[model samples]
Target: MRAIVHEEKEGLEGLKVKEMPERQISDNEVRVKVHTAGMNRRDLAVVTKRHKADDPALIPGSDASGIVETVGGNVTKFQPGDEVIVNPGLGWQENSDAPPEGFEIVGLPDHGTFAEYYTCTEDHLERKPEHLSFEEAGVLPLAALTAYRALFTRGNLEAGQTVMLPGIGSGVLTFCLKYAKAIGARVIVTSRSESKQKEALNLGADLAISTEEDWQEALASEQVDLLIETIGNATFNKSLGVVRKGGTIVTFGSTTEDEVTFNIRQFFYGQYNLLGSTMGSAEELREMLGFISDHKIKPQLDKIFTMDQYKEAFEYIQESKNFGKIAIKVR
Candidate 1:
């Protein structure tokens, strides 16, 4: 098998593609011939040491869709030739107030999907949505699951409500825009790039504004019911300003800086709900797939690169050049 291996937490320089031994499956595991793998901000974070990993040699990818090539003795959910998508989150099986202590995402301490072949427990695999291509399915798991849980599960977003998503270009936020719009929510998005703002509107956002613009002023007539905040310190206070009184704000990532300052009195007086979320449960992944199938939603794919071009893919994402998911064609 050929795999992209990172031997140190020193950033892109640590990454290299090399021939590796094929993975072996356990009794409850399935070996997949990876067709495509999706890249996430977390993959870059781990490579750069922003996110810590205990493993010295790590295969860094969390989202992938592939065909099941072999199954272990105890496996029953899938067999050879079954098209499947990997649920990147481990543990956290069902909806809960919070993930259990032992919960961990795939592609960190464990070897991940950025290879010719990968293996995971049967419980973490799901049938790929029929409408999506392998590249689209590869990018759907982590971002779609995160967006699904953030909007519906944590934020409790409903149709006809107004929701605001800051930093619209990332995979999760793009998914958020599509999902929220599909559910009849009025979606408003902000982006530093004018092109992304226009793209969001084309994707069903009711309004798109520049982050430099005064979003609170622009949206004065229609306050936001739910605000998905991912650009932490740089945009959190603005998010607080745009959300309606008593509205909910759900945060999943801090792409800017983690530390943020906001008016404590305003938060208490408004009786607002500030929630934190992460990658979702397996059940949510299942439901998300069904939702995508039901709504006929397809993930926005920014670009697809061959495994040999992994460095260029990483560079593209690092430079914020993508409006949606960036994927690697592994096969």
Candidate 2:
């Protein structure tokens, strides 16, 4: 199998393509012949060793679509030659501190999908929708599920409510805009570039603004009911500014700075809720796929690169100029 592996934690320099033995499936696992793999910001962080240092020689990719080459003895859901999308997240923990149901994502602390052949536990595989291509299915597990869980499941979004999404480039935010529109919610997306604003408008955003400074002023009349903050320190304070009283804010990325300064009084007095969401459950992943299938929502791809050109792909994402998900065709 052709696999990307890191023997050390020295960033992308450690990532190299090597011919490694393909994985053997366990009694409850299934082996997939990977077709397409999606890259996330976390993949870069993991490759760079900024996060998840427990495993050194990690093959880090979470989203993938492939054909099941073989099924383990205990797996009854799928058979050989079945097309499937991998759900990188397992089920939520049975007992959590506050929330009893909280999901644990894949691609970290476990072997991932950045190779020609990969093994997944049977519970982590979902049937690919008939309408989607392999590239589209490969990108939805992490990004789309995260957006669905944040807005509809965890954030408790309601129809006629207004949502303020800080960034519009990533796959998560793009799907959030699509789903929000389908549910009759007004979406206000913020982009620093005029080109991104126009792209967001084309994708059904109610209002797209290119205000590099004081984005709150861009939303002069709307009071945000739910805010999805993907850009961290750079716009966290500004994102909180336009959110209405009793609104909720869900954050997924800490891209800029983890430490942010905000008035605690404003949160309490305004009665706002600040929440954090990761990738969603397997059930949620399947539901998101169904919605996309029904609505014919296309997974926006910024660029596609071959596995040998993985370095160039990573460099492009590092520049943060892409408007959609970056994909690498593995097989």
User: Which candidate leads in lDDT?
Assistant: 1
Q: How many clashing pairs per prediction, in order?
A: 0, 0
Q: What is the lDDT of residue 12 in candidate 2?
A: 78
Displacement of residue 195 (Cα, Å) in model 2 is: 1.0
| Model 2 RMSD in angstroms | 2.4
Query: What local lDDT score does residue 328 receive in model 2, on the 0 to 100 scale?
Result: 87
Tell me the tens digit of each residue's lDDT in model 1 across 171-204.
Answer: 9999999999888999989998999999998888
| Cα lDDT tens digits for candidate 2, 176-250 | 988898888999998888898899999889998764766666677887999999888988888888899888999
Full-model lDDT, candidate 1: 0.90
TM-score top scorer: 1
Provide the TM-score for each candidate, comma-separated. 0.97, 0.93
Assess candidate 2 and give its TM-score to the true structure: 0.93
